[model samples]
Target: MKQLLLEIDETTEAKINAAAKTAGLSAQQWLQQIIDEKTVTTWPNAIKALAGTWQDAPFSEELRAAEGQDISREDF
Candidate 1:
């Protein structure tokens, strides 16, 4: 594990400490958990989830034709 100092404003530090206590964790542990959750949520997992869900949806020919028209207009 790496240890480093963080300089935060007093209000931000107080909020983090309070949240850590509410969750029954040390401030460092709580911060680490938040970072891990954010990393996972913002990664390719989100894109894969969207793609999987959209795969089963019915095809829309009208939507496809509209998209083609939009693409052609942007080519000019």
Candidate 2:
């Protein structure tokens, strides 16, 4: 395990302690939990479940037809 040193104002320190107490965790554990929550880059399970929910939506056909068809070329 690695040790990290963090410096904070007294007010911030107090808030961290209070929040940690409220969550029934030590300051270190609370901070670790926060880090874990923030370090995730993938979609949550609920959102992952929605991946193909829109596959058959009415607009999919229109959007597919418009893909890569540029309409902005000059006539000159």
Candidate 3:
């Protein structure tokens, strides 16, 4: 585990503290989780950036059909 120090405005600090309390975590723990999520290099955003220029991609009809397979009464 690494320790870090950050400075933010009172409003932002209060918001983070509130969120941490709501999720039953300490302010430090919640802030660390947020930082980890933002800094993780090999996440979904990185993968999408690497796959550049999808100009010739074909839409999969099978996927389109599968999307509508699960129907519910509320869907109507």
Candidate 4:
């Protein structure tokens, strides 16, 4: 694990402490969680779950099938 040194003002430090307490984690753990959440590379599960949900959605091929014709027939 790498160590990070941050210089924060008193107000920011207090806010971080309060947030960490509320989350039942140490300040370091809260910061680590935030870093992990921000650095994620893939779609979250909630978004991935929406895949293929539109029953009548058009594919890329379908969209190009008839250019200039609007996708009005597309369900969603």
Q: Which candidate is the best by TM-score?
A: 4
Worst 10 residues of 2 by lDDT: 54-63
Candidate 4, 1-76: lDDT as tens digits: 8888999999999999999999999999999999999999999999999998879867898878767666457577
**CA shift of 47, model 4, Å:** 1.5
TM-score of each: 0.52, 0.61, 0.48, 0.65
Candidate 4, residue 25: lDDT = 100
Measured on C-alpha atoms, candidate 3 has an lDDT of 0.82
lDDT preference between candidates 2 and 4, better one:
4
Question: Alpha carbon lDDT of residue 21, candidate 2?
Answer: 100
Q: Which stretches of candidate 4 lie over 4 Å from their true place?
A: 54-76
Residue-level lDDT of model 3, residues 1-74, one tens digit each, is 77677889999989998999998999988977988989987768757886765665567885486566655577
lDDT of 2 by residue, 1-76 (tens): 9998898999999999999999999999999999999999988899999888885756776868857666798899
- Residues 1-76 of candidate 1 have per-residue lDDT tens digits of 7889989999999999999999999999999999988887454665667765655655798558656554345555
The TM-score ranking, best first, is 4, 2, 1, 3
TM-score of 3: 0.48
Lowest lDDT 10-residue stretch of candidate 3: 67-76
46, model 4: CA deviation in Å?
2.2
Of 3 and 4, the candidate ahead on TM-score is: 4
Name the top lDDT candidate: 4
